[model samples]
Each structure stands twice: as structure tokens, then as C-alpha cells.
Target: MNDSDRNPIEDTRFGEITVRQDGQNGLEVEGEGIPRVTLERDPESEVDRQIAIGTRDPDRLTMRIDGLEVGLKPAKGGLTRRSYRVDVEYRGADYRLVPDSVPGSRLTRDGVHIGDFSCDGDEIVLAEWKEGADIRPEDASIGYALASAFGTGGQPMWMLLIDAVGLATP
Candidate 1:
């Protein structure tokens, strides 16, 4: 079989975001909730002719932008596997958003980071926020992990749990 044929595509949705996995090394993303802005410039007008065009597009006006990246490799058992890392960035905004497995961690609506769960050894753990005081293995949630990873203010209860359970590598 050809190398391209060996790879498979996958798709999943997290919250309002729809993630598409392409051929073990490609990702195409499309969503309906992105905020956007439209600006119009008149070719006939000089510097004073530039005017702000308003767009009713649902994606306009959002603080975050979505994008994708991919990496592929050969795993054991002759299986071709692709690793995908999804990320977001906050433009002109303070605070970084990341994924967490610890319970009670706060999830920010204005930050950007990867939010996903991975298997570590025999348990599932959040991929990001490896060093925080809010990660808890037992009560892990997307929100709590964000709080711990980004330091959004929360008790260290989850952190202790994550430490006790031991983090797994993805």
C-alpha cells in the first residue's frame, strides 16, 4: 500500500469547536463561533477614504483565533501514527489558557491553549499544565485544569491529587 493510504482521518468535537484530523499529518478546522471584524478601503479615496466596515459574521469579534499543526511518525507494531497538537493564542489579552485534569481548576473564556486528555501509563491525564497546584487526578475537569495550568486562582486541592496519581506522558 502507498504511504499516503496508510494514514487515516479522524474527527471529534470539543465544546463548540469541531476538530478534524487529516491523513495522520494534516488538519483542517472550521467552526461557526469565531468573532471577526471587517474593514473596507476605497481605492478612489485617499487617506481619509478608509472607513471601518462592520461584519455580522459570527466569527468576528472573538479574542481568540483557531489554527492547526501536525506531526507524523512510525510507532511500534509497524503502525503509522500521527500526533496532533491543537493550540490557540489570545491576541492583546492577558493570561494564558491551557488544559488541566485537576478538579476545581477554572476555565477561562478569553485565553488560548490546548485542551485534551491523554493516557499516562494506566490512567488518563490532562496534556498541559504539568506544573501547577490545582491538578487533581480523581476530579479532573477541563475547567479545573485550566485554572491550575494558567493560575486563575483556585485551591491547590487538585494539584495534590495529580501529584499523588503521577502524571502520564502523551
Candidate 2:
């Protein structure tokens, strides 16, 4: 059958857990299962990537990312809820600006602003310059600066400070 015509049912292992994909969007597994586990996808969201991390057997941590859900196997030490960091990369730059970094500051190829933005293990927090401001794909200067700052590995003091100060003619 063609790719689109194929409603393939496949069983795969995520770490030590087993997962069965009913089709393209439905999933089931053998376990106690998580409570109220729902997957949400926001294409308009800043981050373009999503993933679910969980463990195998008795204790499972399942997360849905990019409209798909996956299971993560616990490390050797056993099941432990670990925080994963997701960085928002826009236009070859991070939204969070790091002070005193190389390339000075720049944007990504896709015109996405790289920011110190991260997901706090539960929710994704995107970098916001102004509350109501919308990010344009064409203008990547600010995004680039932010990405560069984040790559430099420091809290986005510069961007935060700049945003706090508002616009100035210098």
C-alpha cells in the first residue's frame, strides 16, 4: 500500500516499556498508564521540536511532543523524573541573549530567534520581548542576538535588561 494508505500497526519498545501505535495518531501501551495523559501540538509555538520521555514497566513517565507521544526508559539507576531542557532556536540564534559572546550576535538561517528559552520539565516557556508583540520571520537580528547569547551559556541578562529598559534612541 502507498504511504498514505498504510494504517500500519506496529509495536515498538521505548526503553524497557512496550508501545503500540494503533495508527498514525493513536497510541496504547501495557502498563498502569499515566493519569490524564494528553498530547497537545502548537505549530504556531516558537519551538518546532517536541518529544516525550518516559520509563519502562511499573513506573512510566510519558510525554507527548509535536502531536506524538513516546515512552522513555528509566536510566540504570531506575525511574527518576529528570528535567529536560529545550532551547528555542530561531534564525540561527537563541532568543535569550548572552553577554560578551562570539559572532557578536546573529540570526538563524530560517530567521528564527534563538533564545535562552527552555521548557521547565512540564511546560515550554518561550522568550517574550513584549507581551503582545508578534515575532516576524523576516527580521532576525534580535533573534540572532538572543541565540548567540544563549549559546554563550549565560543567563539572558542583556536581553532582559534591554527589554526592561524599553526602546531608546541612544
- Point to the candidate with the largest TM-score: 1
Candidate 2 structure, TM-score to reference: 0.18
Q: Tens digit of lDDT per residue, candidate 2, span 1-170?
A: 01232232121211111233322222322222221122222323333122222211213333332324433222222111111112233334333232222222222223334323222222212233333344443222222212211222223445646765786535
| Span of 10 residues, lowest total lDDT, candidate 2 | 77-86
- Model 1 C-alpha lDDT per residue in residues 98-151, reported as the tens digit of each score: 223333222232343323333321111223333333332211222222221122
TM-score of each: 0.23, 0.18
Which ten contiguous residues of candidate 1 have the minimum total lDDT? 74-83
* Model 2 CA deviation exceeding 4 Å by range: 1-115, 124-126, 130-170
Residue 20 CA displacement from its true place in model 2, Å: 23
